[model samples]
Target: MRIAAGLIAVVAVAVVSSSVPPEPRRAAAQETAVTAGATVETEPVAHSGDAADDPAIWFDPTDAARSLVIGADKKGALETYDLTGKRIQRIPDVYPNNVDVRGNVVVAADDDTDEGVLRIYLVDPTTRQLTSAATVPTRVTAHGLCLYRSPKTDKLYAFPNSVSGRVEQWELTVRGTVVTAKSVRLFTLGRAVEGCVADDASGALYIGEEKVGIWRYGAEPDAGRSRTMVDGARPEREGHLQADVEGLAIAGDRLYASSQGSSDYTVYGRMDNKYLGRFRVVNSGGVDGCQDTDGIEASSRPLGTAFPAGVFICQDGYNLRGTTVERQNFKLIPLDRVVLPIGTLPIPYP
Candidate 1:
């Protein structure tokens, strides 16, 4: 009685849509207060265009007002939304599948192009917008993308996952404002891999292997293939990941992965990869609950009154906020509201 898989019913690509259904839907009475209300909801995008797949939170070093939520439309664009969920800029025809931001550097997957490369962009502090900076050709068609800025070495890295199971890591070097990438490490999960995130402080890389589960690897180039499956769908295991694990996001010491099979999110300890609890976004503030979420992101940086402690963003598969019909959009949750009330986690940023 697993909950049915989410957006896979609409995704035409077999490699991406193949997923194991989650256990039956849990009752609404079990919903947690951690996801009670969203601070903002973005405008709707296409329903079945493979749009609004992933999001990356970009923090402005100089001004909190300059922060942005960068997301992949998947169809052919990289969209930048203000903290209020308004579209401020759109980079068209890039065919971005996923995006990640660190400092001024922005990395996105252009797997739809014939070249199938990873594109790098830099945020302009003056304009508070993104501009094309460079491109790194990947060995395989990129499906998932994440960026890592090593806390130890301070070197920047880009990781892109291919539908065929290849994961490539590239170290980026900048010279005279031009960014260049050199592939440093390549590995395989031997299964479809999409959602991925890297913890710079811990030097850990977490990737979602669709039907299988979430796996973690070392973030270093020399870090070998020896890995750990943080959670799985197997019944005998204590792990709670159902199937078709779609997105991975790290906030402080907690790792959040979407269990699309059950339409819920499983939370784990980022260090030990231990399952702590689970929660789902429900209808609040006149907005519908998010289901079949493909991509999710969070930042621990305080942003004024709305998100004093930080913010969390999840892709809403079926958004019916203002209109009668449904489309895809994003939901924002305050980090303080989630962690403070739960008493499960120590505030990471504070």
Candidate 2:
């Protein structure tokens, strides 16, 4: 239950004289994608209803226009959108908070189960449909989730909110566009963990615990033990860590995390969990954007008919609530304003 004033729609452009950071190769080892004064192009994408919850962008190296955008709804529906925010598909049978597309498929981790239950769904890019993949019979108040592929073993790992205050990993099975989740390994975080992203460059991971703080979780095979690249550092918040610790993603050299109702994006250094300034996203000027963000994704796909690269999108929950007591809307955030050379195009989603 938070409300804030809005500024009129005024586009601000900053000089990007600094050398554009290195491309997202497999060697940069950068973590969070910084959106610093990222300019916002004046274009706007339209969608139906109030868009809320998590979203993921699928990279289409072959067809950028055919690329995909998927998001979570308040009623267990995963809606698909094109780059222009056009409704392409609506995947069902999911209680998802966050979704990620890693290896040719979409994986969703949602906590709509009673008691302790973990339900993961796999979405087919070809058909724009969802299949109930795996159900781990455990109790985790899952909210924020990140999926990663082990650079060496190529095993899949999921970082979700903990029932016992630690992050766990599982062996995700992908068979002909179907992914099922199974037990692999479980690890301890400083506290209840949520946001997760892997540094493909170093085969390491960056984890964000809402209250416990930001952490760098890394590991080895048999020769020794896992280690924390960044320890004892935490992100500052105004409320409980559980206040919808929803989004987590990485780009060049930083980690980005957000919480609903807080109205600000939290930042940390990839090398260490030191608190960076928080950037607030506002929809001034009667913009039809909603702000209670729940999901976020970064991609350099392209514009026009598909999600573009370096484009940052998030979900604004609580939209259209109590409106007919029937349905709600999904909100999108374009990160071009806080960061530059990024995607300026509006999230035209359905």
Candidate 3:
């Protein structure tokens, strides 16, 4: 999720003036004590400080071992990494807060432009590298973004949201190497909002309001602003979600979200939105755990032997090497190691 423009500028100044980085926050007691560790850690972002924000995993159907993981460096670049955690490609000169992929098309919410735009790219299947295709402008100041391919129509859609709660849905079309987008729907969520994900199978859209909670809306273009509350932050109700709800992703019948305030991840039943449990990544096997996470992504498709049941990727806010803090980076966890609620089935890739 993108921080408010005003706050970002102020924080930027402080970071520039300070020689020493601040200490990382500790995680408080949670409802569940379950924990897991990352199997792979990506190379740190090019810039220092809070530059790494979100990630997206692209499954290579032809060759599972060739699958790629793409991430956004809010400090002005988008990076692609291989299954072994090596940085393969870096596209510079753009401030992308969040990124998502559908098939071969990768879209990032570019905040560098005056009126936020979506930087589009098509991945080369053979080389597994991203090639710039087009730049589509958005109506709102794009802070968060996610892509969806409809099950009914099979048409691609992009949901780019702003810090002011404005979200616009655009239909994207690709012909040859050219790409275009058309606005189809718009709505406001009342407060500062960011993270969002679309359930193509159920036609459901989930949006996270930083101070409030997550809301459910229709993914169809004609579906109006009518929404239902899926879950709320503390003090509002008895729930697991902490304030500043950030990146969201779906794996099979479960929905995963970054509980930013507590430095953990919360799980819910995708069908009923029922709170299942929560877990934190802890230090293990020579690699440190993830803390103060900002963005997360998960997949259920088998990807090689290491991640046979799939993998989960998260942006580690405080990349620590023992007690000392290092540059921010993403962690890859084997999904099968994460214990889920009872009756959760392994749904195939969408």
In terms of lDDT, the best-performing candidate is 3
Highest TM-score, which number? 3
Query: Who is ahead in lDDT, 2 or 3?
Result: 3
lDDT of residue 188 for candidate 3: 90
Model 1: residues with Cα > 4 Å off, grouped in runs: 1-35, 46-48, 234-238, 340-350
- State the lDDT at 307 in candidate 3: 91
Judge candidate 1 at residue 54 and give its lDDT. Answer: 91
Give stretches of model 3 more than 4 Å off.
1-30, 235-237, 342-344
Position 48, candidate 3: lDDT: 88
- Model 2 misplacement above 4 A: 1-51, 114-123, 133-141, 177-180, 219-245, 259-262, 268-277, 284-286, 301-309, 318-336, 340-350
Candidate 1 per-residue lDDT, tens place, 1-350, comes to 22333411211222322232122344222433234457688776543434788988878777776688888888867888888888888888778888888878889988886657898998887788888988778887888988887878889999999878889999998765699889999999988888999998788899998878888899989898989888885342345776677888888667888877666678777788777767667666565666678898877777667787777788876555333334577888876555532543443521
* Lowest lDDT block of 10, candidate 2: 20-29
Q: Candidate 3: global Cα-lDDT? A: 0.81
**lDDT per residue as tens, model 2, 250-300:** 554455666443544655554454555455454443333334455666643
Clashing pairs in 1: 1-24, 2-22, 2-23, 2-24, 3-22, 3-23
Candidate 1, residue 250: the lDDT equals 83
Which prediction has more favorable lDDT, 1 or 3?
Answer: 3
